[model samples]
Structures are given as structure tokens and as C-alpha cells.
Target chain A: MSNWRQMMPTTEAYLLDKVLYELHHKPDDLAAYNEDKAAYLARFRLTPELAEKISSNDVAGLYEAGVNPYLLRAHCIGMRIPEDVSLAALRSLMKEGDDKWLN
Target chain B: MAELTGIYTASHTPVMLNFPDRIPTELRTEIFGAYEAMGRDFEAGRPDALVVLSNDHLHNFFLDNFPALCIGVGESYESPIEHWLKAKRRVFTGDQAFGAYLLQEALKADFDPAFSMEMVLDHGSLTPLELAGLDPDLPIVPILFNCVQPPMPTMRRCYQFGKFLGEAIRRYDGAERVAILATGGISHDIATPRMGMVNREFDERLLQLMEAGDSEAVVAYATNQVHTAGNGAEEIRMWMAAMGAAAGLPFKRAYYRAVSDWYTGIGIGHFGENSLATVGSIDG
Candidate 1:
């Protein structure tokens, strides 16, 4: 099984996915996240490391920590994070057998 | 007796509705034309209702409450839930009785699909229909498969469900004609590192298998190797279900093109004896 599936059921992963989902869908949450990143994230019971990852726009770290890639990508778009940054982060996770279709 | 008019499948991407100009004008025209062609075939079936099998894009359900399979029994459905989606906000007429019938039949068959009376549909259901230019007044039933999240129904399970649904549709006396449509995926990545890459080889091979009416081969290949295609390609499970509904009728490809700009391998085809007799492959 993939890491995305393994880490999905944990409280931390759930919190991370929930916050990202809100940041993308809820206007008030997005405004709050933009106005005060720490204050907004404080609403959730996220771990310090998970909060830091969300706070720092750590796409790869969040993904490795089990944020659904689709949700992570949508959140990045909502946050106005450049495509290249997330692309580079995603690229770092690819292995030899991954993305063989691209070749 | 109600007839299973036809089983159709297509790939859904927001870019097709959101950013059509990203691709060349000619390619865009052809893609739209292909959809229109499918629409014509759908109309020819004279279906009393359309049953769309698509997945929710986290618009309706979140991680907190997600079901592996859900059926919408609402009297009407508000679709294109995304405000950012470049499509009109409209309500689709729903066949509440028909949807309820399917739900009851599914339960009798031991397939416990969650049911909702007020499920808002996202682009997954709206895009293909809107592009196909289907009639707004025509009633529809939406069956949502959880392709986005993990632990989704396997390809074989979806196949079995489709087969069961097909028999149920034929047995229903409420509707004289019902058309089935399954949307999503040939091979394209989304939001990941290989975001813009489209897998032509995977798309063509899968289409070939479908064209040959090899449901077993399609299910086997899609289940075992879908991971290599892309995260989005998991939606091919819907295609497997469509195959099951086809009941081994050979598919005729209406159009197929690998559009990386759309971040999806756009392919459209229908299963049955009435569709285009020859396969059409258009690479963009």
C-alpha cells in the first residue's frame, strides 16, 4: 500500500487534510489563514510539526506526511503558491518506476 | 420492460470547461464536437433518464464522512458546486423514484451504497453532460463512486456493481429507457509532479481492450497497473463499471486524444451495437 493510504486515518493526517480543505473551500477560513496563519491553524488540534508544515507551505512534507495529493494541489492553488514550487516538491518524491509514462 | 439503452464513458477535466483556450482552437473545436457526437448518440437512445456514474471531488464529502459508494435520491440536484468552475450554475432534474428503486435493488443485491436526498454534484457529473449539450429538462440519476479517496471499490467490484445495476435497470418498469454514462480518466496526472503528462500508451491500450469488448482483460489490466498511469487514472474503475453494464458489447471509440494542457487523456466511447461501427482515434 502507498504511504498516502497508510497515513490517511491518523488524527494528524486528518487534521492536515481538514485544514487544507477549509483553506481552499471556506472563504472566511482562507481569509483567516491569510491574515494570521498561526491563529487560523490554532483552531485545529494539529501537532507542532504539522502546523509548521502548513505554516511554511511545505508541499512535499505535507504530502509525505499523508495529505491527499489532490487536496494538497487544490490547496496550493487556493494559496497562490506557484505551480513550479509544488511541482518541484512532487518531483522529489518520484522514483525510478514512477512516471514511466512520461518517458 | 425498461431498456438499458447504452453504456458510455468519457474523461472529465476541469480545464475542458474552465480553460478551453489553453489548447489550439482546432483541437478545442474537435473535442467539443466529439462530445456533441456522443450527445447525439445518447439522444438516439431516447432514454427516459440518464444515469451518471462519477466521483465527488471532495466538494460534497470530506475525509470525516466519506462513503465508498453513494447514490443520490434527491428530487433535483444543484450541480457545478465549485464557484470557480467556468460553467453555469443550474439544477439538474432528478428521477427520485428511479434513484430509490436502484437503491432498494442494490441493497437486495448486498451492495450497501450510501444514499443522500440532497447531494450537490460537482464538475465530475456536470462537465461531461454540459459539454455533451444534453437536455436540461431530462431527469438524471447520479451514482457517485469514491475514486478520489483510497479504499475505493476495486475494479472488479465496480464491474460487479455495474452488472447488477444493468440487470436492475432492465427489470425496472418505471422508465422505458435509461442511458448510462461513466465519466473520468484515460491517463493523466493532477497536482502532482507529473501534472501535465498524459499517458498515450496507457490510454490507447486501455481503449483497445475496451474496443475489443474484453471486460476481463480490462478489469485485470486496470486493477493491476492503474497505479503506473497516474493518480487520476484510478477513475478508470468507472470505465470498468461501464464495461460491465455493456455486458460484453464491443465499444466503438467516438474520439480519443491526449491533451496534456487539459491534464487528462480525453477519450470518449460508447458500448452497444448501435454506436459507430468503426473506431475513431484522434490524437491532439
Candidate 2:
């Protein structure tokens, strides 16, 4: 099992911080952030299609297309993404996948 | 003794009630129609008091000292947040006598329940009130259970309490007709890594067990069965208690929908319209 704490560089802050960092800075001179992002993505083996879906904020499409549950959860809790993502899209995703939430 | 004239159970669908985009327009219409049918029953029964069993969503009760079982005996109850919910603001009076009796009986039965005078109702209780078309001035005895937070009651204990509550309600005396309502559950997960999962098959089976008055089976399954049936299923114990209150009554499934997008197995059932003449008493 992947140590979720080890997948990311900084474990001190909440998940929202990681998302905000990715949104603000695509890459940095320091290799630490890049290694962290790469490690995080590698832990789930997120496909390009899944990344695109997350970027598009199409929650229904993600679930309908059978997106990985781990990645989906990470995105939903803003653990790996910023909160500025469209609330409308998030709400739609929630509605589409309501049945599966507690299950 | 005040008879439990009716029973209603509701849960947060976690979706726009009538939004076409969220639920297909046709399905939405059908769901609303079912709500209307439930309303018709409430209108016919005209219950003098509604005993609502619901869980607080961290809105009113925080993590600390949040009672596992709480009875609200305030003169009036109000929901702190109403903007997000379409429900109208309404004040409900409490039945202190009945409330006190329930507390005492639950304790005597070995369940250490709590009492609150300044409790505020949240969407869990308010959603059903809106669906039932109940007047704001209607009297209600709110029973808040610890389902959302940790240290929840065990399935066996919940069912046991249900049996106890059945006796408590029958012991109360009043002219007003009483209605027992339990809100929450039909398979939806929230606030965790597994958010937005719904288990339709489990929901259907639970309804079946409830209709059969098989509390033993329900308790056993809740303890040993797959968690998908009830990741947050502890809340459904409220419904079990309400069902116990109306044991021996045949219930009709007014509505059942597995709207995955809404992340809920929306179900509404009713009793009292076709109740058995005699119900066997539950011994502590």
C-alpha cells in the first residue's frame, strides 16, 4: 500500500494546499515539487483521460466512464485539486454518483 | 393512550428536488408525484403530533458530547439554515409529557438517552416536514440520534431501542393522533474518500426486512453484512424504531428510487392505513 503521506512532498498542510500549488505553479526550478506531483500521480497511475476529465470537471463523465475511485475521491475532497474548480460541476458529479457515495 | 395514527420516513436525496438536469424530467415528475401521495396521507391523518427521528449533520450537534440519543422538549423548534433547503421556516411545539416518558422508558430499558431544550432541526428532519406539507405550528417531538458522528449505537442496541420505543409511545395518553417518522438512509456515502456511492440492492432488502418486522435479521445483517448497505446506515435505525412503533402494521412502499447521481436510494414507506389489530409486545 502506498503511504498517502509519502506520495506528496508536504504533509503538514491540508489537501487544498496541494491542489492550489498545482494550479498556481505548473513547474518550479526545484525538483522536489515535480517529484511530488509525479509520485502522487504514479501512486494512482492516473491515465491522461482521467486527468483530462478532472481538468474538465465532468464528474458524471468521470464516473460514467469508470474513472478510478482513488483519483475520484482525491479530487472530490480537494486533496489534490484547488477549491476554485467549478462548484456546479462538483454538484453535478455528486448528483450523478450519489448512489455510490456510501456504498 | 395516543395511537400512532401514521408513520413517515425521509432522507436527504442530495439532489435538486425538481431540477430537470439533475434527474431526468420524467423521473423527477414521478418522484414528486410520490411525495404528493405521501402528503395526501398526512392531510387525511391530520396528525396532532409527529414524532420525527433524525440525525444531526454536524450543523447543530458537534463532535463533543453529542448525545447518542437526544429528545427535544422545547416549546418550539427551528432549523438554523433554510436558504439552501427549500423548506419554509416553521416553529414546532414539543410534547413535554411524551418526551419525558420516552426518556424515562428508554433509561429503564437500559438505553442512556439524553434530553435537549434548545435543539435546532436540520435538513434531515426538515426535508420530511417539507415533503409532508405539515403546518409550521404543528406539534412535534424530535428524537435526534447519533448516526453521523462516531461512537454510534450498535445495530442490536438500535433495534432493541426500537422495541422499547414501541412500548413508550403506546403508554403515552393524549387526544392528538401521533405519527412516527424516521429520516435517513437508503445507501449514500458522504464526507469521506468513498463519497457518492449508493447500494440499491441493499436498500431494497432493508425495506423488505422492515416490512417483515424482522428486527433480529436487520440487526444481524447490519453487524455482519457488507458495509455498502449502510456505510452511514446507523441512521436507518431511526426508521427501524419508527417501524417498531407501528409493529404488526402492513406498510406500502410509496416510492423507491436509486438515483445514483443524487447518491441516494430514495425510499418512502407508510403504515397505519392497513394495520394489524394486535401486535405482540417486545420484552426487554
Q: What is the TM-score of each candidate against the true structure?
A: 0.93, 0.69
Which 10-residue span in candidate 2 chain B carries the lowest summed lDDT? Answer: B275-284
Query: Candidate 2's residue-wise lDDT over B79-145, tens digit each?
Result: 7332334455666777766777777778787888889887778677877667656676777888888
Mark the regions of model 1 whose C-alpha exceeds 4 Å error after superposition: A1-9, A82-85, B277-282
Q: What TM-score would you report for chain A in candidate 1?
A: 0.86
What value of lDDT does candidate 2 attain over all alpha carbons? 0.59
CA error at residue A82 for candidate 2, angstroms:
11
Candidate 2 lDDT, A58-78, residue by residue in tens: 555554453322233334433
Give the C-alpha miss distance for residue B120 in model 2, angstroms: 1.2
